[model samples]
Target chain A: MSGWTSVLVGDPRADRMVPKTGFTVQLTVFSSAAMAFLAVFALALSLATERLADRWSAELARTSTLRISAPQDQIAAQTEAALRVLQTTPGVGSARALSDDEQVALLEPWFGPDLPVASLPIPRLIEIVEIGDGFDATGLRARLQAEVPGAVLDDHTRWRAPLVAAADRLRSLGYISLALIGGAMAAMITLAAQAALSANSQVIRVMRLVGATDAFIAGAFVRRFTLRAFAGAGFGAAAGAAGIFFLPEADVAGGFLTGLGFEGLHWLWPLAIPPLAGTVAFVSTRTAAIRRLKEQS
Target chain B: MIELERVAYTYGGAELFADLSMTLAPGSFHFLTGPSGAGKTTLLKLCYGELIATSGMVRIFGQNTREMDRDQIALARRRIGVVHQDCQFLDHLPMAENVALPLTVSGRQEEADEYLADLLAWVGLSGQASQLPPQLSGGERQRAALARAVIMSPEVVIADEPTGNIDWEMSQRLLTLLVELNKMGKAVLIATHDLNLIRAAKTQVAARVLRLRGGQLQAAGSEL
Candidate 1:
């Protein structure tokens, strides 16, 4: 078999050459488990932020608003004119002026309920839903400025841009966190493998004396650490996934914090952590073993 | 077979040995004798491709030691069984597994299984087979080291002080084993301070003895 295949398949006799118990074993398992657990959380954070960003982008992109700020006597006239202008506008799916009660509810979070809205000269608000590719905001603004002088058109671009950017940045941070976790795990595994190799210097010498190739000697360490990382990461990922599952269900009222869990096939992402950890361990341990063997030689 | 032509070794900017020439033809027997500071072990390491000569060609199985990479040296080492004075073994492994190590590393575990039992018995180590190396007495460790060295049935056996720590009777037993191996047509080279052991071997096998001192190698004449 090829050297890599032999490393993965592992010879029991070859593995027996290394001592079964040592601090490196525990260190590798613990570090892999801890890193994998963190990686699962990072993955969830990335996926959740991606979902949030998309939802905000898509929802905000599909609708806009119009506000008519005018004299008390001219409010009705401008609202009617704004609605008429929007109706004829291409790509404007529908437009409706908000009822006083709806407007009051929107303002209730900042201003307390039961506010006297009719007594106050509040600006009239119009909700515009878009269809297909949506209306060109510049054209719609020009039309509203010409036809309804007191009306202002908002395409929600200003608000959506920053919110989506923030979420996108957060998603990127999550991915960066995952990468850091992977890197940290690799570093820890490398150190552990180096320590194990140093501790087993006598073992290495004997193996070398007995005609063990560097590949065979290194395969023993790589196989052991790889399996440990795999097993540890498996348990860690399962635990992390379980923690995410038991989190409070996503609530529209609870916002992004409540939505921090895998959805559908995204759950499969954590399943890859163990194998990825195994691969990292394999590479790192192999590198460390080969380097140490060369130094010893 | 192994050969060294005008081989010289230096350590820490000082020449340990120079102008050394030797050959281990198939079935030949030779002994290397030297003072404590002499570079006998270093010369043996050159023969097995463990150390590169400072000046001259040291070839193992016809390949120059200087030109062989670590992997190539390892491959060549498989054909050269080496018994160290300290009898290095994987302490965690049992005596049987330790003896079978050469075959195991060579991916010939089946051959190890075939030969391990009889080999252990031949070395008078059958009773200690299941015990660990640390648990074995000095003599048993020496015998086990010899068994391990020959497990692959290497072409030549290079041993450095093979009986360094064992009793006289145990040393004689180990020497007899080496004699039997030489009779079987395997070249053998041993380095030791034990002139008595060399004398004992000369009686049974036509052995050539060489001495290394003051960075020079010379054939010993009537030394014993």
Candidate 2:
């Protein structure tokens, strides 16, 4: 932090040694801002993906479905037997059979709502909500088979595995995108610093002849570039946050793409982008300036 | 004070000067003269620790320059003012700012106000203080460079062809300023091919003139 203060309130005399670089200043600021703006989206994506993965893992892991498929007259008897077994099982919080209307609503997207559910020999579904650690599917299956001959236990492993895996991959990709943005910012700033050093070779030689140390010379450049990055990234972060704020509400679409934004307190995360960009620029510019100054000496 | 003992310099497999030895004691005045490409500038550079000798030793203020790092060399330069032949200046800055550059670099910018005004007046550049280096004539620029070189009141002053671009009157004026600094106990070394300036300096102070020819330094005849 003290270093930041020094960079902001540098020795005015030292700053005078380096002339104002016109286009390089604009180039550094523009690129850093653009990178910071993109980084905000990457951060949002990573956070959103993480939230989705957690929801899928927690909701799916705790619940299972008991389906009874038997003759029309025996289905009710088997479903009743399955519920009785589930109630006595440890870790089973509650067991209730879904009504015909609820089942019809669930299948309305795949099948027409006007289907004759009563006339069809459809299987009965019993939703088993788990308590503490959730019931063991293997033990539950064995018990259901002995009690209700036509009952099947599904723990949702098949559905949850691929959804969670995809979410995890998306989260990792988001992080990689952030890393690439930071690396690109550093690379661009380094090149700009090198150009400024080369263009001001005469100033550097004169400074050296007048008894200025390499650190003093390098500080002038580092401070200028770091401040530019900070300001530019600040603007970029603001613009990015605004863009996210104005995005269509997640409830409007009820899709994954609509959820690709920051949640309540998560919005504070993008505020860090400016300082992080400033630090990157500071390190990159300092390294480049010192190396170039050493070479000249 | 500066000392060079058996100092040799080679650039691209070609020797500029070898076995060169000299010392500038306190309050001493010396002149280095040579024809074009005779290594006058190279010797000045060695005295100021700008270029390390290929062999032997060059010491400034009793410290061997070979052991000094870049920072140490910079600190040493603070005590040794140098005036190049071309009179380099930050072209964007005004004459007053350029003349106070040594003070500014040394973190003595506050002291610049008082001494800068007097130095500019001494160099007859008071009227051109606000003008940039590019706007100044050759004589004015040379004067400005001299003011900058002496802003720190360095113990030693090394000028390479200080009067190369100026007229006769301006050369004399620059020489008078160098003589005045020598009188004030500053070791002064001026490298020039102008024999008239060397003779003119001799009337003001006792100066040792050394000539460099065929890549060697030797005492010239007492022609002046």
Candidate 3:
């Protein structure tokens, strides 16, 4: 042991070793890069889910519904009276009874377009848009119950709760997926670093005997793995960006997955992945290298 | 200085040496002559704090090897230089780099240029300073190892078969360097099977020759 003055030792030249096992390096990089890429996508999904949930919940939060049903002649009369009542109520932004043509159009997707919507005894629909913090839906329902005797208030709580909960669940799932990807990247990089360290076992011996410290030896491997991870992550991120770029222009798929992709300056979020991968590799490789060195003595 | 008292070493629980006792003081030169598998290298390892004795005490610079932590051992090792038969080198690095490695690992890299030059010149390796370790001849490697060993200006220099793979002329050159270090007040311990080199060194320095054989250590001429 060149009498222990040096605390670091390893194949300092391993950086120039050019990696004879390119396939394994590639395999490891691809595995980590893919996970990171998926993580980027999951992060984007979570953010988008938040935005979507907020838009839907904010727009629908306090809105109530009015369904009027009576004899054809009385239906028009009751709908007019309900609109008048809502207009006079506090916190009601605007109340409009759906026209016969509008009601037919709403049903057109399910029923044939040629249906005579005016002749059917279908309930007259009135949409109540609320813009204030508080709404007296109970009072309005009571008024309609006693006066119109054919009107019911639907405050949208039943369907709105399930929709918001589903969106929240999706956002949570996205975050969980991102976390798992980070874990997998760490594991793969650790394995690759261990393999490289073992391959140069004799090199480590020479370095150790020459007075190189555990830190110096560990630093060389950490730099190598961190740089490799960065390179691979850059390539993967670029590929992901290009793939997302050629995605069908927003109008095509009607929504969901297409809108699920990034927009505007938000596209820059995935760029952090390469550096993140490098950090992961740096930490994992360091831990693994130090553990191996300790085991050697 | 190194002191061993009732020390024993084992690998896989097989004792290589038992209850060995010795002390090396400043400016003293000692030759450890032993048969094969006599644990000469192992004993040197204990002396340098590379290996801890399984039983009893092996102390260097007044600190027991068994009690020294890794960093403490490394700091202790700065005062001791060891040259091995294989002459381990970072083959990718130049001879100068390999020699300056001790300074580098100790974070004294700032003085590598000056000290490295002096070390290479002393070892007669000035010409091979820029060459990679693999490019050097076997004797050159041994010389480079010696250069690396002494570059830190150690108080004690230990060699495990420093002449095991060299010519007679190279062995003499190495022995001359070890004697010079001893004269400079550096304690020297060399383990070798070469009786010729031992006899050569015994004349120049007040060298005590000890032999390890059949799991027992004795003075060379005690049996005679």
Candidate 4:
């Protein structure tokens, strides 16, 4: 704990021992900023995809559709019989047959305006909402088969499963992208740190001759690089959050493209990127510094 | 105190020196004289825990160099001040900060603030405290290096060619400061090829002279 605190609250005199101006400084800051910007996008994508999966699963899982296809005279009788059966089921919350106007409106998107609901032999659709554990599909199907010969029940299991799985895979991909970004950032920072150490070999030799410990020497470089990374990452995260905030608002017509951003308290997540980048810098620089100092000895 | 027991050092595939034994006791002054590539600097490094002897033991302040980790060596180094021929310093830092570095590294910066002015004054570098190392003259840089070396008040002082780059006057001044340090009961070991400087030191303090040649260490007998 004291080590960590010292890394944060560095010794100014020791810090002054290292040259402040070098290409390695620019490299560390630039790479951290760029990676942090990319990380923000990855985090947002992961979270957005997760929310999409849950929303789709919940909305689709709670409701089902029953389609009735019969002789024109028997269609109403079969829909009513399906609705009646649904009403008596233990887990069925509500069931209603779509009126002609409602069915016309539902089909309008596919069939243009003023869809001819009465002229075509379109199947009568009854929407069923579930409650508690949800009604057993097999039992409902068996009863519907006995009471209504042309009725078929769809619990949305096939559609919901595939959609949720795809969304989950996308979320995993987003998280994997985040990991890759972090790894690439670490590699870049390590290279930059090694370059700085090599450039300041004289400084290190002087410090060592003056009885400076490896921890003291390493702490100087670690603190410098860590603060650089933290500052750069903070800037990058702020820019990214601003970019995300200004994105087009979520719209039903826009669908997936519109919903690809932070929602509500999720805005707080990107705040962690700066500290995480600082930590990565601290670990990578410290490891590289210690190893280099050992080799110098 | 530092003790070397039949210490041997090898560079690349060949042996540089072997069966080299020496002891640096408190308040003693010794001069190591050798030709170029005679392993004087390497021996000094071994004495300070910078390099471990390949085949023999080097004990600094009662701890074996082979047995000590890097941190332990570093801690032991705090008690042994070393002055390099090149007078190494952090070029970017001012002279005052560079001199105070020993104390800063040891977490004794407050003591530096107390005695730094006095230390610089002792070396006659009080006016050049804020100047960068690159701006200082050779003699001034050497003095600064001396100041830095002794700022920690180490028990033993090892200097490699302390007067190699300066004129006769500056060399004497530097020698006077080192002689004063010896008088204060700090062990001093100087490695140099300067016979005149050795003769000059002998008049001020009781000093032993050792010569290294052909991978052997021999005590000099009235050669100076």
Per-residue CA lDDT of candidate 1, range A1-297, in tens?
875577668899989999999998889889988888999999999999999999999999999999999998999999999999989999999999999999999999988998899888899999999999999899888888888999988889889999999999999999999999999999999999999999998898888777788988999899999999998899899989998988898875486789999999999999999999999999999999999999999
User: Candidate 3: misplaced stretches above 4 Å?
Assistant: A1-32, A249-252, A263-265, B222-224
Error of 1 at B66 (Å): 0.3
Across A1-297, the per-residue lDDT of candidate 2 in tens digits comes to 266787978887678778885678999999989998999999989999999999999999989898899999999889888988988999999999999998898888989888789998889999989999888889989988899999989889999999999999999999999999999999999999999999999999898888888877888899999999999999999999888888888889788878889998999999999999999999999999999998987
Report the C-alpha lDDT of model 2 over B1-224, residue by residue, as the tens digit.
79999999999999998999999999999999989999999999999999999998999989999999999999999999899888989888888998888887777899998898888899999999999999999989888888888999999999999999999999999999999999999999999999999999999999999999988898888896
Over A1-297, each residue of candidate 4 has an lDDT whose tens digit, in order, gives 276798888888889989999999889889999999999999999999999999999999999999999989999888888888999999999999989998889989899987777889999999999999999999989998999999989999988999999999999999999999999989999999999999999888888888889999999999999999999999899888888888888884478867889998999999999999999999999999999998998
Best by TM-score: 1
Every candidate's lDDT: 0.92, 0.91, 0.81, 0.93
Itemize residue pairs with steric clashes in candidate 4.
Answer: none
Native-referenced DockQ of model 1? 0.84
The sequence of per-residue lDDT tens digits that candidate 1 reaches over residues B1-224 is 69999988889999998888898999999999989989889989899987899999998999998998888888898999999999988888899999998888888898987899999999998899999988999999999999989988999999999989999999999999999999999999999999999999999999999999888888999967
lDDT minimum window of 10 residues, candidate 1 chain A: A1-10
Q: What are the clashing pairs of model 2?
A: none
Calculate each model's fnat, 2 decimals.
0.80, 0.80, 0.30, 0.86
**Candidate 1's C-alpha lDDT?**
0.92
Which stretches in model 4 have alpha-carbon errors above 4 Å?
none
Worst lDDT run of 10 residues, candidate 4 chain B, spans B215-224
Task: Name the lDDT value of residue A103 in candidate 4.
Answer: 89
The TM-score ranking, best first, is 1, 4, 2, 3
RMSD list, candidates in order: 1.2, 1.5, 4.0, 1.3
Off by over 4 Å in 2: none
DockQ of the candidate models in sequence: 0.84, 0.82, 0.38, 0.86
Candidate 2 C-alpha error for residue A217, in Å: 0.5
Q: Would you give the TM-score of chain B in model 4?
A: 0.99
